[model samples]
Target: MENYKIPGHLRLETRRWAKKILEEYTLESHHFRMLVKTCEAWDRSEQAREALAADGLTVVDRYGTPKAHPCVGIERDSRTAFFRGLRELALDVDAPEVPRPPRTRDYGSRR
Candidate 1:
């Protein structure tokens, strides 16, 4: 059987959202592509930033400096929210609205 896998960040985010404490969401292909670009800016930082913004992600690094590169710094919680919203938006085929599931137990819960 072929082992299919989502990107690391995507998978982490998905698990995080499954737990809740995250509500609203907004994610688009353009945004995802922007993330890719941000992660690839080791050479062309300025160029990557311009391209990312054109693609649309509003990316900022941990240092609060304007990001000028491509990266996939998406954490667990945020990753899930982003992808969920992106999926919904794609399905709606008009204006993407992220569907919110009620809060649930955290990972390794016995509740």
Candidate 2:
């Protein structure tokens, strides 16, 4: 089995997530690169979210008009990138077993 190290610079949560994914999956070299990019995007989204939480969601411009905080867009774009990477990884298809249905589903009835 090939050994891959998680990048040191990732945020705590992102590092944990990356570690878990690495442990759960056997990724090719290209897939490892994608995972690193995805982790970076996750960290970027988290950083933007933190900034948005510290600052208000909207900021006033020089004209005194309130506009969405720049971090809002950063967070949005980063989240999009992260999800796209996940789709490309196709982790769900590689899982060892099929996932159970959500508890909200009515397993007792046929619809």
Candidate 3:
């Protein structure tokens, strides 16, 4: 029930946990749309800023556009915002953990 807030930077700690949280909470149509818009804006802003500032050695395509990097998805500003949004709006639930096998020691060893 708070005002629309976007984080200044990505929260690295929340990256993995974000997916779990999102899976638990289902947002209403209105809120979901707003979050999508915010994420899209952030994705554009980050890509544009970094692409313009890159060195000549930076890779590009035949069209001269910046080459897609795998880290981009992990490092995007939108990803951070989305994670933060997930933490704020999603419900928290403890996963049902499975039991681990017990360790056993052999008392009798072959002589």
Candidate 4:
């Protein structure tokens, strides 16, 4: 929808993606909100990744011990959020199959 404007705060790539999705899908108001949240998550993930790349994946703690960068977790969590939002928006290409529990033998039940 031309009337729906992508948020200016979003990164250029994120903006383009959001625009394409908006044009391609017939989304309700709630879906639009989800789209925005998804885009924000994508942007946040990208930002964290960039920071990680520049700073390296580890950082020295106060005790002089190397630990995982905070951005590492941020990137991971944001990526998860983005994907979850995509699923919520029904924009993912393939629907994830629900896992079914395996059947167990009833050894305790006497015939």
Candidate 5:
């Protein structure tokens, strides 16, 4: 996949949304492409914001899931690992989203 760049200083959630676009667009082309269009509309045209807001969408990530770039577990030296074999850089989409399952884990007889 080609490295598509976007502003990195935006809030984590918004960057996450854009990260979603960069990561999944190849697999889920239609769905993600539409979301990309929505993102473009939100970014490019002023009027589309009103329409999106009217339809209950925000320019930022709809789900306010906190995320970290390059993440916590990825080894700092693994070249083939994501983050393009480098540490935290502004325009790298290499960090995959770490999976955080909801609070559904059973503590098993908390006493």
Candidate 6:
């Protein structure tokens, strides 16, 4: 099996996504779904860098102090090497398996 190497920035982005919706933010399901889809499209680590560049954002994957695009203008008193640590941790978490709903079986007996 091939080793899946996720880019640090992508892991940071995943953290950003989690922060945006997890708990405090409480992002709506629709918005979360969209984010999930977007993440799926840019699943590769290298893709994270490209995606950020395409969006005019510069991200440095530091262990504790991941930086977003400069345009965001967010200040920080402290920094860590872990880029989006929460998100990176979340990536390993198991997602709930959603089983497909049963298909409608037409019963002619009612007719």
Q: Which candidate leads the pack in lDDT?
A: 2
Q: Mind giving the per-residue lDDT tens digits that candidate 4 earns over 15-110?
A: 999989988888888788899999999999999999999999999999999999999999999999998998788775556587545656975584
Looking at model 4, the pairs that clash are none
Winner of 3 and 6 under TM-score: 3
Q: What is the C-alpha lDDT of each candidate?
A: 0.42, 0.91, 0.50, 0.89, 0.43, 0.45
Q: Model 3, range 49-104, lDDT digits (tens) per residue?
A: 57545633246778998775544543466557756764544345444386545656
Q: What is the lDDT of residue 68 in candidate 1?
A: 38
Question: Candidates' TM-scores?
Answer: 0.19, 0.80, 0.31, 0.80, 0.24, 0.24
Model 2 regions more than 4 Å off: 94-111
- What digit string (tens of lDDT, one per residue) describes model 2 on residues 1-111? 579888899988888988899898889989999999999999999999999999989999999999999999999999999999998898987554867567666676867
Candidate 2, 19: how far from true, in Å?
Answer: 1.4
Comparison by lDDT, 3 against 5, better one = 3
The global Cα lDDT (0 to 1) of model 1 is: 0.42
Candidate 1 residues 1-111, lDDT tens each?
222222444334443432231123243445444443333322233344456557555556798876633422333333455455545335336653765555666745745
What residue pairs clash in candidate 6, if any at all?
A: 7-45, 62-81, 63-81, 63-82, 63-83, 64-80, 64-81, 64-82, 65-80
**In model 5, what are the clashing residue pairs, if there are any?**
none
Q: Backbone clashes per model, in order?
A: 9, 0, 0, 0, 0, 9
- List the candidate numbers ranked by TM-score, top first: 4, 2, 3, 5, 6, 1
Model 2 clashing-pair count: 0
Q: For model 5, how does the per-residue alpha-carbon lDDT over 1-111 read when each residue is reduced to its tens digit?
A: 555555654445656777875775453444344444444433333333344446443233448754432322222222223233122222335556885456546656555
User: 1-111, model 6: which lDDT tens digit per residue?
Assistant: 222233344467665654554544434455454445445444443444455557656556667655676533321211121234334334445554885466567645555
Tell me which of candidates 3 and 6 scores higher on lDDT.
3
